[model samples]
Target: MELFFFQLLNGLGLGVIYFLLSVGLTITFGLLNFVNFAHGAFYMVGAYVTFVIVSLTGNFWLALLIAPLVIGTLAIALEQSVVKFSYVLEHKYQILVTLGVALMLQELVIMIWGPIGKNVSPPSSLAGIIEIGDFIYPKYRAFVIAFSALIAIVVWWGLEKTKFGALVRAGSENAQMVGLLGVNITRLFSITFGLGGLLAGLAGVLAAPLRGADPFMGVEALGIAFIVVVIGGMGSFLGALVGGLVVGVMQSVMSSVWPEGASLMVYAAMAAVILSRPRGLFGRA
Candidate 1:
């Protein structure tokens, strides 16, 4: 079952990327109760940032460092200028505003990078493959798995152990009370939004070499992220992780057996999950 193992590895790699993307969306929704339809567009921007930086300096590592930071700043600015106004509105209104933001960012990317997709090569250091017995794997992909695992650990620690994480959890439960305690809820919202953007950006950067950067990739990424979030349950950290892996593995395995129906299977899986548990696997009632 070398083939199965290969696909499994692929799935895990993809799952981590999905986890990174969905975790940000999950956190923002969990805390601010704000729906960010533009989350995917922010992800696209980060990929573009990596694309641009690598094209200019020929340094994948530098792009990796800078792309997320740039997106984080942009997200913070957008929150202060636009997203903050929607916090008090209904979810529908929030969706509309964020959808508008997504469209704007998509068009902006097209204007700058054109509608064509661009490829990003892995760094020379990770350009080769590792072989064991009869199996082989890409070095960059191996790096993705290890690096993402490290990130996941750091994120868990930050959320469960840090003061900021406590405040975030507290804010999610009772933002009004948190504000009553003089926690500057407005600033927290901005930071939370920025954090979401940062994670989305990081996912984009990591995914660029594997999938490349395209104007429409954000839309697809958004759909996948939503699927993961829905399957795992919104605002549930563990749900996001498990759901991402499940989706990733299913898609990867299906690709070999039913290439055309691979995407359909993801939706089918979601449907199956919904038919049984309406609130999602981990969503609160």
Candidate 2:
């Protein structure tokens, strides 16, 4: 029973991270109809930026506040200058361009931060263990789960209840119609792109303490995020949430029982989900 509870809590923490990592990717796809393979690059940049900021200011809170903004602004610039051109291109072209961009960004990170990885310690306030009814867990991990959940709630509210979200959803179905309705889709696209970047960046910061800052971390996370997105259903916010938790918990349990096949379990789950529901658990046709 103790082991079960431990694994469940740990799984929830991992799920929250996956959720943060993939939500932005789904939003971009759902609203803008753009495939951005470079989203994970933003995640890498966010972690590196957080490391740099923390090193300079000795304040995790400051890094938390600024790193996402930096990445978000950079994403906005990229959308305006480069990605905008790919918007009208075929899906293959978009994939090629974004993959190229992702490679370039990875190389850039290596040049700036070196090939070595860096570690980040949790904030002093959160760097302790908490005990509850004979079950002990790290405070930082709990914080990660709670903080990510809070963000998830905010995102849900923003998208499901806000006017901008409605516009985005409507645009996803018929962009031409939304444009005809005088919605200024170009601006909307930019905002949505930046928002996605911001979410990825935030994920990076939250993950730095757990996974460390590595140039290849983005690539690794990108694969898992893709799986989560696929499992949850492309463009479905609820899908992302449910898929993330499911994958996270599955991986956690597998790691304990069959450490060697832990990674394979997520893929297996993805295959099963895909086979049963082509559109994903929460995805639309």
Candidate 3:
């Protein structure tokens, strides 16, 4: 029973990571109708940025503050220079261009940070454990879960209750109508894309201490993010949250029981979801 509980907690922590990673993808796809295969590149950038900042300042908090901003700024620049041109093109073109961008970013990271993975230690405050009765839990994992939940709340409130959220929703539904109403739909897209990149960067920073920083980390994360987006429903924030948690928990439990089939379980769940609800749990048909 204690083992199950421990695995459940670990699963929730992993789910939080997935939610942060997938939410950005969901937002970009939902509002911009752009498939950003390079989103994970920003994630990798964030982790590397955090590593550099921490190495220089010896402060995890400082890295946390600056890494996302740097990645977000880079994302905006990329959107302006490269992504914007592909927006009017077909999906195949978008995929090819974004995949190329991702490859370039991965190589850039390898050139700058080396091919070997680097470790990031949690802040001293978080590098401890908490005991609850007979079980002990890592403090950093708890922090990840709480911090991610707070972010999820803020994102939900902003998207569902704020004026900017309304504009984004409106733009996503009908860009022409929104443009006719005097809104700069292109600027909105830029902001949305940047925000998505910022979220991915934030997830990367959070994950660095646990997962380490590597050039190929983004590739692995991108695959899981796609599965989460599909299982949750494309462009659906609620779906991302639910699907992330489901996939996280499923994988965690399977790791303990089946070990080798852990990853397979996620695909199985996705297949089952698709067979029953093609649009995803919270996705609109």
Candidate 4:
């Protein structure tokens, strides 16, 4: 039972990482109708940025603050130069362009940060453990849970209740119609992409202490994010959240029970879900 609980906690932590990374993917898909394949690379860049900032200042908090801003700016440039070309290209071309960019970004990360990975410690204040009866949990993990929950709520509220959210919903459903109403949908798309990049960056920064920083981290994280997006139904916010948690918990639990099959299990589960309902749990057909 204790082990189950521990795995559950671990799943939730990982799920939040998925959620943060996928939210941007979800929004970009939902709004721009762009199938972004380079989202994971954004996550990796954020982690590397955090490492660089921390190495220079020895302040984790400062890295947390600056990394996202820097990443967002860089992402905007990538969009203007590379990603924007996909707007008129066929979907296949878009995928090819983005995938190529992802590969190039990975190589760039290796050149800039070197091929070696680094383990980053949580702030000293977050190093202890907390007890619940006989169960003791690392305080840093607890911190992850709290931070992720806060972000989820804020995102949910922003998307579901605000005027901006309403505009996004309307624009996504019918960009041409929204543009006819005098809304500059191209501008909206830019903002959506920028916001998505920042969210991914924030997720990367949050993950740095727990997972360490590495160029390869982005590739793996992107796969998890892709799974989450697929499971939840592309473009559906609730789907992303529910899918992330479900996949996260299942993978953690399965890894504990059968290490060899851990990787295949999650993909198998996704296959099952897709077989049962072709459009995903919340996606449109």
Please give the CA lDDT of all the candidate structures: 0.93, 0.91, 0.92, 0.86
lDDT of 3 by residue, 1-285 (tens): 889999999999999889989999988988888899999899999999989988888899999899988988999999999999999899889989999999999999998889999999899999889998889999999999999999999999999999889988887688789999999888989999999999999999999999989999999999999999989998899999999999899888889999999999899989999999999998878
- Model 1 residue 142 CA deviation (Å) reads 0.9
Return the lDDT, model 2, position 245: 97
What's model 2's TM-score?
0.98
Candidate 4 lDDT, 139-202, residue by residue in tens: 9888888888898999889888998788888977987899999987777777788888988999
Model number with the top lDDT: 1
lDDT of candidate 4 vs native? 0.86
Clashes of each: 0, 0, 0, 0
- Predicted structure 4, TM vs. truth: 0.96
In candidate 3, stretches whose alpha carbon ends up further than 4 angstroms from where it belongs are none
Better candidate number, 3 or 4, judged by lDDT:
3
Candidate 4 local lDDT, residue 30? 88
Model 3 clashes, total count = 0
